[model samples]
Target: MRKTSVLIRSIFTETLELINISDVVSKSIRCDGSELIVCGRRYDLREIKHFVIVAAGKAATPMHDAVVAELERSPHVWMNVTALLISPTAPRHERANVTFFPGAHPTPNEVSREAAESTLSYLSKVDGHTFVMFLMSGGASSMLEAPIDPNISISETAEFYGALVASGLSITEMNVLRKHFSLVKGGRLAVAASRAAAQCTLIVSDVPSHSSDSVGSGPSLPDSSTVQDSISLFEGLQDRVLLPESVISFFNGPLLTETPKQTDKAFARSFHRVILSSTELAEAATRLAKASGFHVEVDSTCDEWECRDAVKYLLDRTEALARIHPRVCLISVGEVLVQVHGRSGKGGRNQHFVLSCAMELRQRHSHITVLSAGSDGIDGNSPAAGAIADWTTFERARLMGIDAQSCLDTFDSFLVFKELGDAIMTGPTGNNLRDIRILMSDHEEHAIYHEF
Candidate 1:
């Protein structure tokens, strides 16, 4: 059992490295003296005088480093280069031309506003001789925000986010509302950059669909959502949600403007590319599982589903797969939604998912081990990445005087896993592709099967 656990952890670690930001950026973006290439689009640097780099998200620093490295290697291409990075933390590598602004995540704050203002100020200076390089990833939406209505207090915005988190809204739905209220989201940033000669956006996608318009609310791409979509989603959740009166009124009233459209002039000179996604992560895990001598099954449903239903769905699939193969490894990639009601405890969607699976495994006396974790290395409000559970997880929790069912009811899976020492902690991984789940069953092989 100990050996199996060690092998599983090793595989997960390797899977994360396969989609690291630095590697992904280095492979996708490059520059020569005459032309700068990104994801196959070429820009003539000889015609551009000034280069501006704006980056945001959890992976902002590393992504910035990668971009700067590429530009530095081709100094003849961009002689005058300036950079502005907005991230949850400071930069890992500091350079004279680069300025880093630290901001809040999962919720926007005053720092987020300052970051937006600084970016806008820099972008406002762009002219036909300038080239804009925008780097965006998962946390960009929260880290880079400037409310359209100055009257809307930051507290009101925070309250709106709090309600959305508690309401278990999908990332797509939440981003629609965010776009309607922000000055920087929904392709407005692209409009601002339109003054430049050309614009290129390199994205590390955390959203399930890998839609350029959905990732980071499409700051540098055209928005597919509209005012009507935002209003319809809000109306459906109004009764069960705790949204501010000001927010409701703002959406219900006619003071809203549509985001930039695909036909808008803003995108005429812009090129958007998704460098990394959840599908790549899942494929990497599948390859590693096969090399480790396990029959691999990959499921690519990487959307936010209800916690309980997701756990049941994975378990049923795993059980059926185990009956046919003696050594089976099921790889499921997606984010689960956990609705927090009343007084909630500390935990993220990944922790809630594994805990639910632990309870079901204990009830059925099944010998299965499951691991769920965020690719970014932070789960919800807790410091732990996520949690790991097996058939013995519930029994071990009981021995530690922790009630698994009670914890799940209050959304406190972090505490339950903490007490049992089953929490997986990787700190901030500087990457966000979504969540990865691994389920394994070896019931048929009572003896450990050797690859020899």
Candidate 2:
């Protein structure tokens, strides 16, 4: 049984390593010129007068690289191609036709605002013969904020965002609120691209259920939510959510076309949406489980979970898996939330979940190893994307003179995980599939103790 657990852990780790690579994933979403035929009309790229590419979110770099490579290979296609890539950081690449912009995630920065302005500037030059490609993924929301009012600053946006995270609001609800505040989100980019003769929007979906519009605030998809929905979410915010003065004024003031109504004609008229990736990482892990001779179950838990109860529910799931014959490996992929009561010290939601899970696992004789990671190679505002925890996590903390319970109480999981050298570091993976968690354990009789 111990041997089986070890094998399962190895398989899970191997699966994560394989599926998270840019090269492998790029193959799944590459745009070959041959696949360009649409609507019974074969649009020849060689005839295109202009070509433009816009890449955004965590997967922006790799996805941009892949499409750029594809276009470069098609010498038969003749056009002046220019690419605009927006991500949390600019990757190490040099292409004459490509412009890389580094922005901030989870909140808009000065750089992000500049990037947004630059995209709009480029959009103004597009013509009817231009073909625009929009590559979108998660985190695009913060990478580009439209700044509905000149008085709305990033600091004020951060305060509202901080309050929203603590309010236990769903991403869908949060984005609805975010769209009203932004100039570039909620299909506005698509509206900009509508000026082009042909527009192709490809997505590496990180949103739950692969909702195209919700991913990166649907810069290409027509907005289905309304301003009323945004107001309701804001008002329902558990007395902890703070609103910026500008946001409050915008919501309260009488402005025409403040939100996207379900019946809005803009959604149906423009843009061609394509979803290229999703929670398939769980499927990759499942294959590894089969290779290791364990029965694996992969479910879209991201869709079923409620944000408010996510942490406690995940803890319960991990505990239940720990009791599962000490041989089976349980893997899950999805996003969860950590409700911040006060100032959170430092950590992402996954780190907080793993730490909280570790506390409970320690009471059960501490045999399990839990790895919780954000697929984007980032978690919260930290460089380390995620963290790992096990039975001995608390024991190690005692050695470091850190109070595990106190840190957990303060929601400082990053600090606790850091002291134990358990944080997982994968810088700028250029992909976002939310979170992946693996739970591994073994029986006491056959378990081997590794000295640190």
Candidate 3:
């Protein structure tokens, strides 16, 4: 048990190290003395009079710092640069050319509005000689947002976001709804800076592949979602998800606005690259596991599935794979769904997911271990990133007077994982690539708890 524990944790940590923000940025973007290149697309500095850098999301500060650091290498780029950075937390750096604003995540605050206003204002006045770059990532939908309507307050906006988080909808669905609700999202940012000579957006995706439009609600990219789509999504979730009254009325009312389409003029000047995502994460983890002598299988098709269904499906896959190999490592990328009920307990989706597996692991009587965690180093409202569970988890909880089923039912898995010393902790990683679930199985059909 201890050997498998160390192996999985080491693989997880090494996988994270492979996705360093500065390293990824340095490789994807470069600036020569007279020109800049992003993902092989070059822009001549001689034709541009200004550079506008607008960075927003959980990874905003790091992205801003990396880009600004790169720009500084070019001759006189800082003097002609204007940047507005909105971070999920307080600003990590203070620069004279960059206006830093701290915003809230999982919910928007008044500060988010301030940040959004300043960004739009800065973007609204760019001319053809100005080049704009947007650093977008997860959390931007809430961390950098403004309502299309003047009557919507920050608190009400926050209430709506809270409802969305609890709705258990896929990130794609939630972001589609966000596009219609905000002034800056859904290609509005691109529209604001449409007069600029060219615009480039670099994204660290936290959604499924080819869904970069969902990242930060695609503020700098063209949006295909419409008001009708949002209306339908809200209708589907309305029975169990109690959205704010104002939000519901706005979505249903005639005043709601439609998002930009593919043919929007703003997209003509814009191009985007997904700099980092779960694909990179999966590749790194798979390499490490394969090197460790385990036959690895990766399944990402179950993304956005309900927590129980995802767990069951993956466990069955793990067992089947273990049958043909001496050892098996089953890697699943992307996040699972967990619909919150009213005011639930103190666990996030990752920890809750691991606890659910504990119940099944208990009955399997095999040497199977599971680790489910967020790549951002946060799992819901809990202090830990996620949790680890194995077949011995249930036996240990019983010996410690802990009720595993109660913990899972009440959404209080954090407490049990903490007591069992199985919670995965990494603080805030400042990077978002969605979530990763690693299952390690050694097909030894030993007896249930008697060996311990």
Worst 10 residues of 2 by lDDT: 30-39
Better of 1 and 3 by TM-score: 3
TM-score of each: 0.95, 0.86, 0.96
Q: Estimate, for each residue in 141-200, the C-alpha lDDT of model 3 and write its tens digit.
A: 998989987688899999888888888988999999889889999989999999999999
lDDT of 3: 0.87
Model 1: residues >4 Å from true position, as ranges?
Answer: 76-78, 444-452
Clash totals, every prediction: 0, 1, 0
| Candidate 1 lDDT, 1-452, residue by residue in tens | 44556667778889987777788899888886588888887788778889999999988888988888888897765469999988877776777888888857888888888888888889989999899999999888888887887777788888887788778888878888888888899999999888899898888888866466778777888999988998888887796688888888788776678999989998999888888888888998899989988898987454588888888888888889988998889998878887788888899999989999999987876667889999899999898888888777777778888888899888899999888877888988888888999998875443443211
Winning candidate number (TM-score): 3
Best of the two (1, 2) by lDDT: 1
How well does candidate 2 match the true structure in TM-score terms? 0.86
Question: What lDDT does the true structure give each of the candidates?
Answer: 0.84, 0.69, 0.87
* Residue 421 displacement in candidate 2 (angstroms): 2.3
lDDT of 1 at 149: 77
Compose the digit string of candidate 2's lDDT tens values, residues 3-102: 4434544554565566643564355433356444432334665557788888998888877776666566666442378888898656557877778888
